[model samples]
Target: MSAVTEGRPRSPWAAPPRPAWEGEPSKAGLAGKGLVLGIACLAVLFPLWIVIVTSLSSKKTITEAGGLVLIPKGITFIAYQELLSGGQVTRATIISILVTLVGTLFSMTVSVLCAYGLSRTSSLGHRWFLMTLLATMFFGAGLIPTYLLVQTLGLTDTYLALILPSAVSVFNILVLRGFFMGISPELIDSARIDGAGDWRILWKIVLPLSRAVVAVITLFYAVGYWSAWFNASIYLSDQDMMPLQNVMIQLVQKQEAPMGMGQAIKTGQLSELAVQMAVMVLALLPVAFLSPFVQKHFKKGMLTGAVKG
Candidate 1:
């Protein structure tokens, strides 16, 4: 028995030491990771820094300095003052705000209703209707046809040209439909048993629970409407009916004219660059302010709509 015990295999503690390379930290690897991360952060931050500096710089300084500013030496608000003062630009800004607000409300309401209706599996022709809606995303009616249709509807030179034609967005509808589908089936059944009709269920149950998705889609619609100019230029012939973007384009053109056209032209050429920057800043403020408010919900909303289905 003693001989058998001695012949048995020894424990792993009896093994030889491993090579030093096995456990040592790699300085090169750590340095590479740090370098990549630093570069990525700089790439993202540089554009934002430049925009802020340009927006705050004086017109004369910006013109003299061939490149972007790292630090603004002299800050001024003269550009902002010129933009807000009475002109076609101010009128257009008012028009744009109104359109954005009204269009967002209208688009969201219609999208919610359409999406909710289509989300139900038992709804008639649901698949076919959904496919038809999606088809419009890839292929649009030609511009001429769309223009003719608008003309036939007597919507030219009117706000309805902007509001009614774009009342529903196919992409937004799909996002909302996916969100509605993600709601628990059991909750819907319970609502039914409690004598809740479709409208009541949508209002009391669906909408309340869908705040994140609704807010995200509302932001999308608002930004789109605020930035829209092509439709306005095409359908609205009246200068008074122009939106801010169109007016800004006209202002830029005048600024680009030769130096000796007239007194007004000379003044425009002198102030054009500053005025352009100011208009851009004004147009961007609403989006900048509103984005952070909805940004918290944006990722969750997009994921709920996209990956869920």
Candidate 2:
């Protein structure tokens, strides 16, 4: 036996002492937490399960149930087939994907450059610019003014209106700026001494190290662009140009009772509860899949890069 293992008397294997801050959790407390988490998971997942099952359920089963189907009597892809058969839904999906991709790219580029520039305390008028940006977060120019501005700029009925009006999120800028500021100045100074410029250092060093925060912000921008219907509803006059969310609102938000799922599957009917659930699933699936992969960094990024000022 090693000297560390040698003792006056042999003892049974046991766990080492926990730190005071991490005292052993009581079994009841652990059980309670587990129970709470389990219930929470079920609360979130049960509705999602019902939506999926309802969407996949046979038209006869749905008609008989007259509500969300928890246990699908029979599975059918008719809902999906109807939704995607060269219809408005298909076009809207493509439009939404394009908007999300292009908007996220544009937003991230502008926000990153703006955050980097403003993070430099030495930059002239940065404080004023930052204050101006922050001020807009609390107080917005009313809808009329914003609409008139877009109109004056000839962005009405254009995709640019959906993208440009709210492209640079002030909150994301602040988060990124805080993260940039948190970086050690010594690294930047050393890079400068090695013949690197501000842009070079920012691209090569700062950005590479700030992946977690940047990814979280990018996901935020993507989700915002994907889910945004108000902008399209206000700016876009042509139904062809409207994003998926706007199309969904147009289809699902009417006060009239939805048509039957069987009618929905056959005659391009879209107002049924099953159809609505299918649309919801389609809209939610992208973000739902994307979030869990990056969720490990989400909390850390939010806490570490949260703007103190």
Candidate 3:
């Protein structure tokens, strides 16, 4: 027996103490875990730091550093100013914001409704619906066929084209459904016994209990919409309708006027590299801001349906 239990008396036939595997972790194990976590943090943060610094650096500072501008003697917001002030990048940023906001809301509403409905085993044809959704998870219509369907639906050259096709992710639906099903059946039955209907029960009881999963899914959908460029490129014929990621690619790859000033790639003042870094920073900022919201919910949500409270 361990020292704490050494002085205590126990029944001769009593079960042995909990196994050593369940004991406190060793110093070496803790140290290894700490090292791995630190490395992971460094991996994510280092590149972001570099991008932010380079974007803030003056042309002269960038030149002195000769590359990514690690150490900055001076800082300037010129790159950000140019990117946000006016022009292609500015328009693209606005479009991306609009799409992300609208798309997340639309996706959440549809996903939540579908998941809630499907989670009810007593719902008419729910099993068939569940099987259909599961089938979608495994098979998708080819890209060309999907494009044709969108075109047929007259969604071409519009923001709806970017949204409706992907508005409901089946995987998200399943996750939410699983969480909803984990709610205490006894509690739900009691609510029903008190004359609470399904909708009321859902709004009053289920949603409140499922906040963590909801928040995590919301973050996931928002990030997807925010960072998406492929749909924008394919659906939006006008360059003006392009999202931030697509326009960022255009500016960086073609070295066009993303820094707001319509100057050519090698304008002696604001270099192409600075403009690229600034664009990246702008693209990354939204997801970074939204990430904290997920942490708050997810830290508690992973076990949302695992055990009854």
Candidate 4:
């Protein structure tokens, strides 16, 4: 029906030559992408750089520099030394470590159990149970009521006060539940055929398979426990039971002098800026050190648990 169909020469403009880079992104486009990534990296790294520099700086230098330092004129480990060797600070640090370790272990155990149970639909009233758990995420008993409950339970002035009340986070439970639901049902059935009980299957098969999510939620619990101060301050009346954060708050805000500082630093008062920065560094070190090891899996773990179900 056409000139080309009749085997005649078509118009020259009918077909255009393919561009050499037609399927490939342009050099400028790649460069723009690289620039954006570089800027984002810089944005994240700059704050870390500042914290490191400030932490390493001498108290005198930090004070002279107006509380922030991008580059230190003189570097010293004196702040860290003071925090580690100083009596009260050292004790508080130890308390914090103990609390975080114990609390996280407890939290992960309870959360994993609850999540696995909720993941299974065979239980009677399972829908109602799940809805009740989900409802806690949106609404909670008021602080006063929680305080009253803790008081009535005689958990005041004790470590259990810190660990038990906040044992199971609804969000963490949901995350783990979604992850459990993502596990192939065939694997569970096979385990069941092998005479594995629910607990045994969870311990051997489910937990090992869900390491990424477990680690992520473990980190979440650890961070929360490490940073917890409000409950400790409220529940523990004894000064000995105070966590590192509460101690740091007392030192920084209340200007409470460390025990041996009177004899060590003739100035009588710790350098507020140095003390604050030192406490921050101490508080941050555990998370900072461990986060990198688990950071790679964090997004995958969270999304797998959150979005899949």
Candidate 5:
């Protein structure tokens, strides 16, 4: 090779050569890392694949497989249709949707406002309020006192029992505070000089610029509310008021579908396992569908909040 060719700089996109202290990886080392990553992926995806295959499998297919279907033979929507057709399951699903939507909205609103209020160093009693919030992170009232407080407020067996008690997430607020504080102070001062009120500035500038963090936090709240069943079991007594997660728990625990289960099985001739897998898919789909849209922001948003704080 020519001396000039050998002396050329490496391509910008190419990885830098390892330092002398860090010797080149052997083929075995590379293979081990690849094996570990492959196993991790399989550990997660394998169960999901099984659940989906079984959910779509025919009665004959499940019978032939002797359990969860490993390979799909033919696709079918019967399990999903059956679940959706059941009155109790349908009611529970609607309740879950309502709870997730309302809870996420309420939590986001409260967190954003609280975070913004505290982000301003000049806000009255900001430090005191922050200390109170920090204290909650270190100590909680425990289950009995919280339950008693909710009961005293006549929130038991009401949707408010789920919404009000957990409406304000101090952690989310703190993360948001970190992000908001990282905004250019001069920009905020400029808005103030332009006669913009605190509300106006937040709505017009801060929110627009902080879309990444907002989307991340919204997903966090939505997923939490959607997947929660324990809180429902504790607070809600009426069967009609149960959410989707609670209904799923009932199906798994009772080993019988409480919601038109007979008709569901008759229509599809599906096994009990098929119904359970179908419910699991329903519970998982929303988060799966939503994540891709906001995943690009997840790392950036989380790191900014952590680093700026």
Candidate 6:
């Protein structure tokens, strides 16, 4: 190389070479890291793959495979067909969907209103309300007391039992209240000057600017409601009213399927494992499809709501 070329000054915009301490990694290190990651991925995905395969396998294949199927052969969706054809499973799935949608909407509305009211320091009993919510976070009514309260209100064996008792989350309220408090007071003042009522200001001004946190909170509540089973098991005595998650628990933990699928099981057309796996897949699909749409907001929302501005 020419001396001038070698001696040329570095451009100001050029990125500096990595320091020797952070120099290129050894092939061994790269290989080891890749190996570790690959193993971890396989470890996590292997069981999921097995579940899918087992659910898709024929009764004979499952029987031959002994238990969980690692390799899929003679794939059949009869398991899914059996589960879906059974009216009970279908009804349970519908119930779960309804609960998730209605519960999330109700919870979000209450949380938002409570948070907004609590955010205003000038509101009456603001400190007391805040303390109460925080106390609930630290302490909860025992299961017996809570059940009695639900029973006293005549919510047992009803859909209201699944929703009303756990409608508001103290943690969610605190997070949202903190977020609302972070909004510039000038914005509220400007809205007030424009003759915007508190309702209008909250709806038009606050919510639009708080979409990220709202999406995160909505997902949180939706996921919680979707996965909830203990509440249903406690409050609902009617088999027809039990949600998918509760039914799933019955199937997986107790190896029980509703009467609709029991005939197929009795006839040796479906295995208990296949039915359980099918139920898992059915429950997973909705959340899996829904997550990607809201994932973009998740990280930003959590971080922004968590950190004071």
Q: Please list the C-alpha lDDT of all candidates, in the order they appear.
A: 0.81, 0.85, 0.84, 0.85, 0.89, 0.88
Per-residue lDDT tens digits for candidate 4, residues 220-296, read: 99999999999998999888788889988887788775665544455723455666667777888898899999999
TM-score of each: 0.80, 0.88, 0.89, 0.84, 0.89, 0.88
Candidate 3: residue 78 lDDT (0-100): 81
- In model 5, the runs with Cα more than 4 Å from the true position are 1-32, 263-268
Residue 262 in model 3: lDDT: 62
Candidate 1 residue-pair clash tally? 0
Q: What is the C-alpha RMSD of each candidate to the true structure, in Å?
A: 7.1, 6.1, 3.4, 5.5, 5.0, 4.6
RMSD of 4: 5.5
lDDT of 3 by residue, 1-309 (tens): 598697788978998898888889999999999999999999998988898899898878887889797776778888777777778888888988998899999999899899889888999999999999989888889899999999999998999988888888887887888889988899999999999998899899989999999998898898899888788778888887888999888877875665347664456768677888999999999888879768977756656533322
lDDT of 1: 0.81
- Number of backbone collisions per candidate: 0, 0, 0, 0, 0, 0
lDDT pick, better of 2 and 6: 6
Candidate with best lDDT: 5
Error of 1 at 302 (Å): 0.8
**lDDT, model 3:** 0.84
lDDT of 3 at 306: 35
Clashing pairs for model 2 are none
Pairwise lDDT winner, candidates 5 and 6: 5
User: Ten residues in a row with the worst lDDT in model 5?
Assistant: 258-267
> Cα lDDT for residue 246, model 6?
83
Cα displacement (angstroms), candidate 4, residue 10, comes to 21
Tell me the deviation in Å of residue 142 in model 6: 0.9
